[model samples]
Target chain A: MAEHAPSAKRIQSETDALIAPGHTLASITEKIASLALKRRTPLGWFVGFGISFLLLQALLYTLAVLLFKGVGVWGINVPVGWGFDIINLVWWIGIGHAGTLISAILLLLRQDWRTSINRFAEAMTLFAVACAVIFPVFHTGRPWLAAYWLFPYPNTMGLWPNFRSPLIWDVFAISTYGTVSALFWYVGLIPDMATLRDRAKSKAWKIVYGMAAMGWRGSARHWHNYESAYLLLAGLATPLVISVHTVVSLDFAAGVIPGWHATIFPPYFVAGAIYAGFAMVLTLSIPLRKAYGLEDFITMKHLENMAKVMLATGLIVAYGYTMEAFMAWYSGNPYEKFMMANRMGGPYAVFYWLLILCNVLAPNLLWIKNLRTNTTFLFLISLVVGVGMWLERFVIIPVSLHRDFLPSSWGSYAGTRYDWSAFLGTIGLFLTLFFLFIRFMPVISIFEMRTILPEGEGGEPKS
Target chain B: MRRRGTGTPDIHGVMAEFNTPHDVVEAAHRVHAQGYRKVDAYSPYPIEELSHALGFHHSPLPLLVLLGGIFGLVAVYGLQYWSAVIEYPMNIGGRPLHSWPAFVVPTFDGTILFASLTAVLGVLALNGLPEPYHPVFNVPTFALASRDKFFLCIEARDPKFDRDKTRDLLRALPGVVDVVEVEH
Candidate 1:
């Protein structure tokens, strides 16, 4: 035991309290669990939740109206068939990608820095995916049938979904991604729920947490199985993080539409997803860490690292934009060339430039190390980047669709009040779900955090 | 409301509380070396080397996920092949019935769908999990295992089972606070 003391000291200095220094494993458990157990919902949470709820209500109303009338309520016209619904769908799905990359990919790489934020990122993935799925469903104007129609089930009417269609691929891809993300999140939550169970004083808390914990006693044998399963899930999720988005990109690339027919959509879309995902992480995290007084847990280094990821992925997205333009010019295809011109100085030119500013120029600021480390700057930049990525989807979808090969069919489009409400409503949906999640569950991984403590690793205590 | 009982006071194991993670890990190693096979150590968090000392290596989860993915690929591709070519042939955009390139996306999706299911279900089945009732919860101080305490439980089912001898062995371990019998 004494011999391992040396190694214990080394581990302490190496992993240093990801939470506050001088905090024990007991303290970490207490602080995190108390946030839920004590029922001390902060004022910020109340304000945030209220705003989210109101917006969500507005969205639901808009959806109800859309269902009552038809797709005509949205600004979906002859040429620009896809509008805010499709654009918003792609945007939210892209936002969901970062969480998977952080939770699964970073775990496989053995990056311990991810431990602090991975839990929430996974929660973000599920919520964002939930928001993303709402679009394609209701966009059909007959969601009940669209949902059942997508599945290849036995029916009296011998009709089948077109196997070659990318939309069908999307149904499987998004649903699979959603289910896997949820399972992964819940599996990780079990041990942490046990912590909450044990510390809970009230009978109601005990029953709730205990059931969620599922008698997780942290037995070494259970841990062995848990670790192995977690790793397997991570390996399983890595490809999904790429493939789901690739299949999504295929939705556009598979299209015969001139601007969307490019081969680069897959990699470009994947990279853009990561870029936007990281920004969303930062956008949510910056305000959150401040509000929750979780600076010690989330840390400045985490923010900087996330910013660096945004910068790297942002550049890939920029390259994607550049190639889309160059290919349009190089191919000498009039429709493709016109698509580029339409994006640059056409009806939606303001959105295109804003996209360039937010996605391209905003990330360039991360080159300055100071800016990356600055939470305020990182937060604003991330928000800008998030906006830019959404606009990027808008530019790609409507601009291309508004003007096809035939000049007679060419027409610009705008989403109606319903479109804006639905889009705004999802923000409410995403935030509402997130706020509730933070209030109930351990926002950070209580069990995983202990590994960073000196005592768990047999490292010498630094202090 | 009171918790449910198993109706028999059958003793499950002898559990010893260890003050430090290092202490219990050392105890685990000694117990394993002394030829006690049904041994388990519980701690507030995962201790990497502790499980190795108890002789647990390799889970069959990866193999399960792989098999699931393989089956999914076959099933999905085959379903499409049969549906379009054999059952209900309908031509759209002049494409062939067995369009393998287009089928790749859905097949890829099916692989993920099945593989993820296998990962979750295989993990639960392998772990004997979602089990809210276990004898370990019978220990009075066992709740501490999720907080700051470390514990080692030696089951009565172990090959070398002797109540007095095991209690004596746990007591002799360094930094052990207490030892108590657990009932199922």
Candidate 2:
């Protein structure tokens, strides 16, 4: 039994080494908390933030022009009424899904590796949702009127938003998603805030963190309730995350458009959202781990696990594409067949093929063990997958809307300068928020990481 | 009852700091067994065993979340049904006014939103948080409680608490690093 014990410990250490060996609880806290506490501001942060800020200015400029010139500032018309606005909206929302999946779903599953990334990923989720809301709100033209009318508030006009409309459902899903995510993120931050408060060198810093900590004393009584509340939030967020994307997909699926009317939209869109989300996570984390020298905490095992998720979700997305093509021909619907044919061989065929290459073919490279562990390769693939997912939304929205049932109504759509600016601006907004978050908050959850220590388990440190 | 000083009790608790979670859990069990009812354990991260040692059997947060979810479902569904079928009705393609299928998404959202909000607020309320001040923070070494230290605090309010005796008992614990009195 004693000999077997050593081998068992060896296997566990090899397979499930979440944190590096030899880290005591104090070292873990100091390493993570010090990034936001003791570490001097890096020069790269300023350069990156400066570029993102300039892009944010572009986004603000675009919004100003859009408000002044009406909806015509973009390339929306009769047939392609949903252009860059809806495309970018879907793309950004899909990217936010990975964060929820990591923080909520993975936590529920007890994936210990999720601890190091969940904090920053949840931050990413909030920022991504922030970027997403801008497109649809601005696209409504009179956003003030839209805000007033879209909600079911008692008003002098005596009108209610159409409950039957998927647009109304979108409003509910997105707002709830934002609210719940904020709650979850803040709840997770409480203990870490306490840690920061205790560790801060200056009085002002202590007060700032102390207020955020809310006088968390880490009492057993409080941990009892905090654990329950956190678990419940995770349980609630799992379904909410799935529902948000499903509702977003329903915005198109509920319509009668040949390409958009499929019953598979919910699952397909959900899978694609996760795929895009993991891609975005990898894209951010690779650079983050490099910049901050967090290789000890955010280990290669974490990266490999994420890559495997991307591959699996990528395969699911590939299956969705195949099913769409198969059903188009199998159902013998001329419109569906035409939609598939047009997607594959029409004027926008390049985008369709490019998406297949990026989303499907590129991620397949991760199946190789050597490439999966290679940071540079993983980083490049993540960026490719991000672009591919954006193109998938573009292909689904505008490409499907361009050619209508009637030959006379057939037309083409292209994004104007405003459309380009709005899309790029959101990226700026996402990065800007992320930069501030990493600077001000513990990017990796400090307390949660402490729990992963071998000492936390009431056992001797292995190896 | 033995009195230490001739004034209102200025000490909050007798705090003993330990280096490891195992030591804290062991100390908590011993402290609790000695008939101290107002005992609490503090650590940088939650140790499930320590909570059990400190006699925390259950938390009411889950029930609050469940109730909040049910309330959200009923309220949102009622609003949707009332608006669509009663107050304002419009015939779009002659579809039914009570479109329950279409209402599912929003209802789900409402339930999750309300439940999550309740979970966070309920836990905070139950724990009496946003306190910004507590007697536990009065101990200088208590700062290490959020770093690497594990603490077993026997409050002055405890029936079995004797300042000198409790301090002596804490000092004798197997893995205790230091013992101090937390001020009120």
Two-chain DockQ for each candidate model: 0.59, 0.68
Give the DockQ (C-alpha) for candidate 1.
0.59
Predicted candidate 2 versus true structure: per-residue lDDT over A1-463, tens digit per residue: 8799999987667545777777887888888888999657889999999999999999999999989989999999989999999988899999999999999999999999999999999999999999999989988999999965589988888888898999999999999999999999999999999999999999999999999999898988888899999999999999999999999999999999988999999999999999999999999999999988898899888999999999999999999999999999999999999999999999999999999999989999999998998999999999999999999998999999999999899999999999999989989999999999988899999888887777554332232
- Prediction 1 TM-score vs. true: 0.94
Report iRMS values in order: 2.2, 1.9
Q: How would you class the docking of model 2? A: medium
* Model 1: per-residue Cα lDDT over A306-364, one tens digit each: 98899999999999999999999999998888889989999889999999998888799
Q: In candidate 2, what are the lDDT values of residues B60-120, reduced to their tens digit? A: 8888999999999998999999988999988988999987898888888889888988999
Per-candidate Cα lDDT values, in order, are: 0.87, 0.90
Candidate 2 versus the native: TM-score? 0.96
TM-score of chain B of each: 0.91, 0.93
Question: Model 1: residues >4 Å from true position, as ranges?
Answer: A1-19, A455-463, B1-9
Task: Kindly state the fnat score of candidate 2.
Answer: 0.85
